[model samples]
Target: MTMKFPFQIIDLTHPISPDSPSWDLDCGFTHSNFIDYEDCTSEIKFRVQQIHSPLGIGTHMDAPAHCIPGAASITDLDLHRNYLLTQSVLINVSHQTDENYQITKQDILDFEARYGRLKKNVFVLFYTGWEKHWPNPEKYRNNLVFPSISAHVAQLLLERNIAGIGIDTLSPDTADSGYPVHQLLLQAGKYIIENVANAHSLPPIGAWTLTLPWKIINATESPVQLIGLVR
Candidate 1:
């Protein structure tokens, strides 16, 4: 059977490769070609590649278990909660030129003032215009400091009961080890999508997000293929 989608599908995931940047605690992506078409005879025409890397290396989503002990893992997350196809809004904060900027409650409020209030179960994404530096370890990971979701803003989203939050940067929080935003959001049963690509392409509202992650049992996080369905 064939399926039809009513909207334009925009890919939001970054390709994972050996050079993919990873958090300090995670190993970089690596792969090996186990089978080559050249090695195959007339009887066998196939090739296989083996991938090795941490689940968090590429564009990925973080489950509650990523930070909180005994929390929901990637597989344990509710389909409705973690991977919902729902309404979304893009709060563009690229104007914040300061490195290591914090996305404050005012930023969210300003967005709402111009676009109306954010509804419940809506997927909120912040486009920092940082994806332009992707795959460059020195610029993307080390030198380019991206904006982060502040704790207060996290609380505001929690109060609004947003389905999930996504960002164009490596994480929703700063490079700091203590991720208060992650902790608060995850603890509230909200998931986070990091390293989102092409966020700048999305509109402020009227977009839908479908986040697809590997159902890895007991895994704290999983690399995801995010799709933005635009009307």
Candidate 2:
């Protein structure tokens, strides 16, 4: 049977490939043809490829175990409960902030003032306009000085009991910041999605996110395909 849906879907994931940008200085994605079409026999017409990628490469999710000891891994999250379909809020801070800006608690408060107080259990996505630089890894990474969420903002989100947070850049924390935001959120059992693409297309408050991760058991992170379903 064919199925039908009634929402406008927007892809929020970057294409993953060997050339995709990496959070780590030296690591990136790699893949190889494991079974080529040229080598296929009469009985086998399929070709297969093997991919090797850092868990943090491209658009991905960081499970609680990413920063917290003995916490839930990617596979540990229940698809239906944690990620399948979730409410979301977009907080855009592109206009007033620069490349090195740190998103503060006031940024969120301002968003709330404009959009109304955030409802609980919603995924908060930050559209920093950083996505425009995604095609240039040098600029996207920006010498590790890209915009990020301050620890203060992270704590404020935690207080609101959000399901998770997403950003259009490499991470919520700067590379040199020692991951204070990561530790705080992950320890509280919240997941994080980084390198989200096409966030500009989503509305500020009504879009719903559907996150599908490459589930790997006991792994700290997983590459994810995120989609926004909007009316």
Candidate 3:
């Protein structure tokens, strides 16, 4: 018997199906088939193919080169410096206000107050309860104008110099497309994790972060295996 705590695995990757909505208009996007092998299956050779979204689709990681110039790609990353990060903090900001639906410095401060000084090199994940309405595309993408880190907040992350920053939404910046926040973080070599799922399942603190991006050679970005290991 494998002894473990009551663990919940949140599939950060979006469902890759025909019914699955996608913003393909933004870029050339496609979710291919995801295969699962069952050793004791009765079906023929014991192989099943599951179709899923693309590398950047669903729960995925973003390389620094995404929004910055002359930055490193996913393939050129330092795994020791990136994956299986220590001191993971899940900021459950689900009960956020809607004035601007923006994650201000005050919010971060409040989190710091309760959590006792967010240490450096830890993965900072912002849980906004955004994935709940993923079944509804419009609401998930437009209706829920959830809190996002400001350009100034990006500077703070740089100041903290954390290993990586992640979010449950499609992006860390607002839908404005071209923003200074993304620019600053990318330029300063800040790694971003996006399209996170089921973050609410995580504890407020003490869980481990394991976000993995594919090493597509000379690629700007790739899909990631976003896993969180906790006690």
Pick the TM-score winner: 2
lDDT of each: 0.85, 0.88, 0.68
Model 2 C-alpha lDDT versus the unseen true structure: 0.88
Q: Residue 95 in candidate 3 has what lDDT?
A: 86
Off by over 4 Å in 1: 1-4, 25-27, 38-42, 81-83
> Which runs of model 3 end up more than 4 angstroms from their true locations?
1-11, 18-54, 97-100, 143-146
RMSD from true fold, candidate 3? 4.6
Ranking by TM-score: 2, 1, 3
Name model 2 segments beyond 4 Å from true: 1-4
Cα lDDT, model 1, residue 116: 91
lDDT of 2 by residue, 1-231 (tens): 988797999999999876676776555677888988888886768788898778888899999999898999999888767755788999988895588889999999999999988888899999999989888887787788888999999899988988899999999999789899999999998899999999989999999999988878899998899999998
Candidate order by lDDT, highest to lowest? 2, 1, 3
Candidate number achieving the greatest lDDT relative to the actual structure = 2
RMSD of each: 2.4, 1.8, 4.6
Kindly list the per-residue Cα lDDT of model 3 for residues 24-46, writing each as its tens digit.
43323444434445454566654
How many collisions per candidate?
0, 0, 7
What tens digits encode model 1's per-residue C-alpha lDDT throughout 1-231? 999878988998898877776666334677888988997776868888898788887789999899989888888877675645788999998988876888899998998899999999999999888787775755777643567788999999988889989998889887663788999999988899999999888889999998889988999999998999998
